[model samples]
Target: MAKVSINLATGSIQKEEIIVGIDLGTTNSLVAFINPDKNPQVINDTGKGVLVPSVVHFGPAGEITVGNEAREYLVTDPQNTVFSVKRLLGRSYHDIENYKDFFSYKVIDDDSESLVKIKVGDKFYTPIELSSLILKELKARAEHALKTPVNRAVITVPAYFNDSQRQATRDAGKLAGLDVLRIVNEPTAASLAYGIGLNPEETKTIAVYDLGGGTFDVSILQIQNGIFEVLATNGNTFLGGDDFDSAIVDYWIEKNQLNKADIIADNKLAQKLRLKAEEAKRAFAYQSLVNDKIGDIWCTLDRNTFEQLILGKVQETITCCQNALKDAKIEVGQIDEVIMVGGSTRTALVKKMVAEFFGRPVHDEVNPDEVVALGAAIQADVLAGNRSDILLLDVTPLSLGIETMGGLMDVIIPRNSKVPTKAGRQYTTSIDGQVNMKIAVYQGERDLIKENRKLAEFDLKGIPSMPAGFPKVDINFLLNADGILKIQAIELRSGVKQEVEVKPTYGITDDQVEQMLLDSITHAKDDVSQRMLIEARVEGEQMVKQVEGFLRKNSDFVSIAEIADTTKYIDKLNAALTSGDKDAIHKAIDELNEFTRPFAERLMDQAISHAMKGKSIE
Candidate 1:
């Protein structure tokens, strides 16, 4: 850690810091501290602008200013003042494909793996490290502004950050030497900012559509009394106002017929034009044409041009909204108020779209950009155990499941099921004479296991071998109130158990989860669709094979006619599996399980009777 120095006529050294609430965002950041009455307040630097741009500039002398002071340097030092690096935070290089268009800076490619390295100096830094730099600056800002030691703070992150990304944020806080009280979700915090102030009569279903500098999130919540339950959340971690800026930049750059080579060669022109375009994009939300001058560059940007450039991107947000509604299983008309958060949502086009979609006005009182920070501070207050009445119950955004017989996803905890919810799913051996079964846990909304993010794996090997498919194994998934996942499993027959303790992995695990995956090289291409087909076929094959093996092993135990009926169903499944026809295999599986009903019933009856005998004596 370095000290902030001041030169008074000649030279000086003053060390001080203060605890703060920081919004470590993609484009901007701010430091907030408690006032005399312990109310959270932003530590404004004389001018009274509470919000700080998360950009940083490295001068020839290595000096830095976080907000407006650093902002002026964007046009001056075009190569420095890293903006929107939050887009790269906790994200993989592969995930970047869906988001790279939002950034104006060039992405430095990594040759080794899926890690993304951005070109900064004659150097490159990982997004986590870069994020730490921004976080450290916030720490220093609060410290220098308050003249007290800043040792603790709370930070906000996108709601959808998987396990790895969440960990990265925590790591960033730690690297900066601040005790990150909790990593609260950006939109969730905004909702808290709005909901905590309302009365019991103010019960309403609020949807938060936050489009910040480099991220977009839509959260549907039911705030009754004081209980804030998040029903559903969906968003592209990369969608935001930054993309809108890029759209304007792309339009202007293309209109002038410039290429990467031309822009890189003329750094000042590029920076000047980008800043102008971004300002125009922001201004178009209020006025039709934003006329501005950047150095010698003059431009009058209009709403029509901005709209035309971003119609597709804007539509993508609509698609995200639709999917979020679907995930929540609610209609637009059911929403009470559309609370818009983030600087980008101030756009007239975005407002019109939201109003048209929900037939309601937006909660315009709370400043979109500042609301999250305020909400975060409130949550920090609660986590500090100050606000006892307010308890936040958030859901794990994705479903969690185990890999079944084949590579198919067998979901235990469905999406939006509620926090601290536990689900148990029983599995049977796919093969006869099998003593051990391995459970691979995953999380995601995808239908296939490969498509989902693998959380962890546990193996139960002490089960007794009867024949093939004799043991019953139950997998239990426990998602706590904070949206973190925990899992455990036990073999019913032998009581053999294994519990999976999920670790704090990098990128918040998902990058949608990077480490949860078995191998990037193995399933990156046919991850989802292929896994579904294979799983279906394997299930059918396992069912059919087990039935045949059962009949052969216990020839005289069952009637010939009964065996023949089950055998016919097994034959259908076997043939379908061999032909690689998923539909037929699925149908055959149902039919085969149906034919085994009587024997299954008998087995259940016998077990019940045998267990009741002990209870009678007691």
Candidate 2:
């Protein structure tokens, strides 16, 4: 029994290949698909739990494990076990500098601009690689359960994930050997699960409040003519049920008068307490009181106390909901539906507060944990050409970008973005007196241009000579209805402009595109490494030029000793750049910046004093 039909657009019979929907969650991930009966179903074949813990572990001998098997390593092998890799997706060491202590594993901090890497034993793994392991496990599970090769999927992400993060996710999927057909927003997918936007003739506005582990997002969406448009989205990427668990742990720690560091340092005790806190959180949902103990430590919590402990966090989410509504230019009364999605929504307090805020009954009919995956299945069905009632608008199948610093792919138009769209970002020259900027257009998801499909290269010449990072250039990508891309580069300060139009898909077969995507995934790690090295070299050269210029201009203001110390550091940096060690060059740069700080401050003070000499008092 299968829902098979012909796609009139292509005049070909569509085969039911069982494309799936995957909810790649931070805490837990799951897969679902539309069944033969045309109903969305979560696959939990042969008692394999519907929720797969998003955890991975590496052994002493480099053996790999994922999901439930890996969850055990959270306590036993905290350093080798990787959890919440989702948070590290497309993030740099600097992005999570403040939250480094939150993870027990080592997140390498060598470069701030390069993508994060987790060190397990002696091997380095990027977030993209770690996530691919999880996705691969999911893929294996699906193929085993469905008895078919599942190679295509629609994955869900937070609505606010920027272009880089989204591309990183798509690359992860590709690495997992799945063609990610679409990257659907979690809120939008959750809405689809509840059948809010399925009617082609109906129109409605809804609020989707998603609170999951390690993240919270509230998105206000307008569904019209079967198009789900996100009006506004607001929430903290770091605030969610994980915070609630921490609150519970802190409550117990304070009551027990135990040393906090003692627990975090002791991985077994930390994991035990974390598990107990999670149990207590779930128990309080049904029972008024819950008690638990791990050895000498006692953990107890009542519903009232637990609610009070997490009330502030809950209130924060409510405020985000209000802010989302405000940004959408809608009142609470304007929301036709309030849909709640996420395992955290199962908490009575969360549901009650969300209801109280919107002044309406919340939609919790579907399992919050499975809703996103189910909705994703429905979307997959639509993509499979099984549903004519749903309208899939035209979207760019691949991201288009221009080569940037270090030959990195700076995405100008991300994949799946609607057609007839225009987007732009401001960039600056990396070297002083750079008169010509080479813009090489490429199409793909990898971070480096070598892994992507290079379409064309051009030069924007006649730029005004200025100090490094002084000339502001605006780069824009405009995609028209005919599927042609128009890229425009303008130097606002110099009034120099250039434009190019390229048909991104011209003369390229689908098979060639697939090969390009495959190559990107196959070489992602190498490409990223090369990109980092090039970026380090570029940065080192720029720093050298800038320091030399600064010393020449400010020699009279700076002390001879300061100039000598800076010159020594600059020479060291120049030497390190030739060594091809990004870490060493960065270290030299930091040292130089530290040494010049005082001199730069004094110069700024002198300039301000001179400028104020003839100024009237306010």
Candidate 3:
């Protein structure tokens, strides 16, 4: 049996669950909580610094290491070490096709819109799984420091993160054995940490300039009546302090006349140079010049040259700030305050440029690396009914979503979202000539639809038949004041529309909701595994059908031998699917794709030739 108490004034939960705030970063991550004195502080367990290196290493015998312990593997065994995984979260292979070389590890690319996966040795892992490992580390750290069970958390993400990315973060937290209370925006959390919007009567418009290790983002925000609204956000996901380090590396490489290819081939030399570059970057902050050496190679840098090297990258952030302000429909003078966040903000150049752009002194009173986490702690405390001075609106207890491909629940309205809200996402068909899409709505916290409760379902018919991934469909969920959910589906290309209304709480009881939440947390691993298997099966089936269609329609252009091989590969894939082994199915899918790619290309060439027949070159 459990107890539940609600605060009538704030509409929050008054319980003993100690929810911590987590700032999961690209280069580092940390967890924080509100101290007994009602002040937020970062957990420094056993004097082991606050920052946890966002790196993981896998041993040969199924052993794993995270944080600082795993960082050494980045140089010793780049193939087994994973870093900067935050950039890959919720992104498809096509989204990062141009930047795949950035990672030293193998990122599997099947030339599809599916979520990206990483391969270390023989096993494959998703970004969500890697991120969960980091979260698990943080959870352990928090529990060790606070001497209490920390099973709930509020995680921060970039303001520009879309629904998919936010959902991915939530899923990672769930996988880490934590109930993700909320997904707070990084800029918003920074504002709270600086006490910029604590006073209910305070009204201000501010800019949060965050430049982390591997990402940069600037957001314009408006705070009124204790409500923070993001006006605009813009930044380059691939631009940040990492770029600065690379710039230094490139400068040294050119100056030393070192072969870039040779440096990449030699791991020790590459790591040595990278470390030296980092040291120079930090030294230039207070010293006029920095001099170092790696064996016989001299690494020398002065502040002037160092600044010049990263000047272009800094200018890019400035441009993004300008664009963010423009999108917010405000001028630099209109901004009340500027907040600096992320370790990169410690650079004098970054501060000076940001100050000059906003015509104000940037706020750096709090530690940039820990600000977001601290703010998250404050939000968690508020949610725990520790404060009544600030009031929060009602929120949904569980996530509401629709059944997507492979019986996966695609959450449209996440748990704890403020009621009377509307959110939507655009989706495309996975099969060609598909005219109807079945919309199965579900309500619960699990990742798989089988574990959730069905509310209602309907079909959006009469879609224009086209190639796969052609027809764009937008799904929207609107929850009203009375908790009535209205789901709408619209096909943008054909102008077709369908909608349905369902009472989510019609037959559901409070005890049932509580059970669902507990089950979601208790069986999180099983739920995620099942979801992944189903997704793999769905993708394999789609690939099998597409390959068969290609062979049938273009038999005249493709070689008979190629057709035979592709057919055999498809049969193997179908067999694997029936066996319910996700890895085996994926392997077969990869083989079939590799064999048919050339055949498809040849067919494409023939079609082009036929279309251009008798046409003038001019």
Can you write out model 3's per-residue Cα lDDT over 1-618, one digit (the tens) per residue?
877755332345655767899999999999998865679999887787999999999999979999988998888888899999999999999999999999999998888888998888777788999999999999998887776678899999999888888999999999999999999999999999998888899999999999998889999999999888999999998888878888888888888889999987888888788878888888877798888778777788899998899999999999999999999999999999999999999889999989998898999999999999999999888788788887887898889999988788999999899888999988888777999999999999998898899999999999999998899999999999899999999999999999999988787788998899999999999988888788889989999888788777777877778777777898899999998777787778777887777776776788799999999997
Leading candidate by TM-score? 3
Candidate lDDT values, in order: 0.67, 0.85, 0.89
- lDDT of prediction 2: 0.85
In TM-score terms, candidate 3 sits at 0.94
What order do candidates take by lDDT, descending? Answer: 3, 2, 1
TM-score per candidate, in order? 0.57, 0.82, 0.94
136-207 per-residue lDDT for model 1 (tens digits): 777766666665667667788877766557656765665666656567677667776775433544677778
Using TM-score as the yardstick, the better of models 1 and 3 is 3
- Inter-residue clash pairs, candidate 2: none
Pairs of colliding residues, candidate 3 = none
Task: Summing lDDT over every window of 10 consecutive residues in candidate 3, give the lowest-scoring window.
Answer: 5-14
Q: In angstroms, give how far residue 615 of model 3 lies from its true place.
A: 6.9
Candidate 3 runs further than 4 Å off:
1-15, 428-434, 465-469, 606-618
Q: Report residue 27 deviation for candidate 3 (angstroms).
A: 1.4
Q: Tell me the TM-score of model 2.
A: 0.82
